[model samples]
Target: MHHISNPSILYFGTPVVLVGTTNSDQTYNLAPISSAFWLGYRCMIGIAAHSKTTENILRSGECVLNLPSVDQVEAVDRLALLTGTSPVPAGKLAKGYSYEADKFKKAGVTPLESNLVKAPRVLECPVHLEARFVSIHPLGAETGIDQIRSVALELKVVRVHLAGSILSDANPDHVDPNKWKPLIMSFQHFYGLGSQLQPAKLASVPERLYRTFDTESAKATH
Candidate 1:
């Protein structure tokens, strides 16, 4: 049975990412965002048009996407209603968000220095991707364009950090899906990945064959 429906927001399950950036004051800011996806070594993250993270990334030109596992849900929860922007923006304030001067402290997460970017990585997270801002794509704007509610940032991953526990025992370079349980967000609720139902036909293709320029670029980068 299928019927046309209009949902207020479409947030189908997606892994949660703690985006780390350097605020203008040279302080660190970590913001948890769920609207993110990857293609090859490039990722697109959707965020509020006026978010402090956005401002920081725009100014710093780099960030760290920290992937917290299901085990860190409590820490991620603590960051849910907090914003780094002082005097919280009207929209966020209306949604019950408040200014959080020290987001890392509020989340009870530790920050570790990143090798490539000024932004620190969340020490509690299982994976960290040091990335550079590639470009920005606006959202919620019509062709005539008056207002832009949000934006999608394209980022190129330069370096990756993975917890050994999440890596495949036989292939340390690869992450074991069964061992990695990412924190997922769906319709404003948190969930963990379930056991795999079945193998996919796509598995027939060698993962190495999909490597792109970004992968090579990562190798050449310091």
Candidate 2:
């Protein structure tokens, strides 16, 4: 049966990404965001207009997108109500968010240096993409937003890091889907990817064919 319905949010599902950025004080800030998508080697994430992570990215132009597996959901939850913004933003404060100076330590994740960016990567996460900021597009500019609340930030992945456990034995460059269980968020709740049900016809195409110039460019990056 079909029926008319409207939900406050349309977040059907998306992978949770721990965005790592360098704060003004040279400290590291990590934010878990689920409004992210990728095409080729470029990824875009939606974040609050005044978030600490956004401020850091705009200033430093570098960040690390860390993908956590299902097992790390506890750590992700610990950061749910913690904001790096000092004094805590008004909206966030109304929602019980408190200022957290050391998100990396609070999340219990170890940091590692990146080759192409100063933003450190989360050692516990299985995947890390050292990225550079490309641009930003404001969201909800009209409809009396009062103020721009969010923006979609584009990023170019300059380097890729992966855990060997998720790589295919047949080809190190390919990720074994069966082995990578990404943490997902749907309607503000955390979940894990389920086992594949059936083979996709799209599997007929080779993943390598979709590789972009950015992938090759990353090889020569420092």
Estimate, for each residue in 1-222, the C-alpha lDDT of model 2 and write its tens digit. 999998889999999999999998888999999999999999999999899999999999999999999989999998899999988989999989999999988999998989889998999999999999999998988855667999999999998999999999988888999999999999999998778999999999988799878888877544
Give the lDDT of residue 29 in candidate 1.
95
Candidate 1 Cα deviation (angstroms), residue 148: 0.3
Which tens-of-lDDT digit does each residue in 1-222 have in candidate 1?
999999998999999999999999899999999999999999999998899999999999999999999999999999998999988889888999999889898889999999989999999999999999999999967754568878999999999999999999988668999899999999999999889999899989988898888887777344
Worst 10 residues of 1 by lDDT: 213-222
Q: Each model's number of backbone clashes?
A: 0, 0
Q: Report every candidate's CA lDDT.
A: 0.93, 0.93
Error of 1 at 135 (Å): 0.5
Worst 10 residues of 2 by lDDT: 213-222
TM-score of 1: 0.96
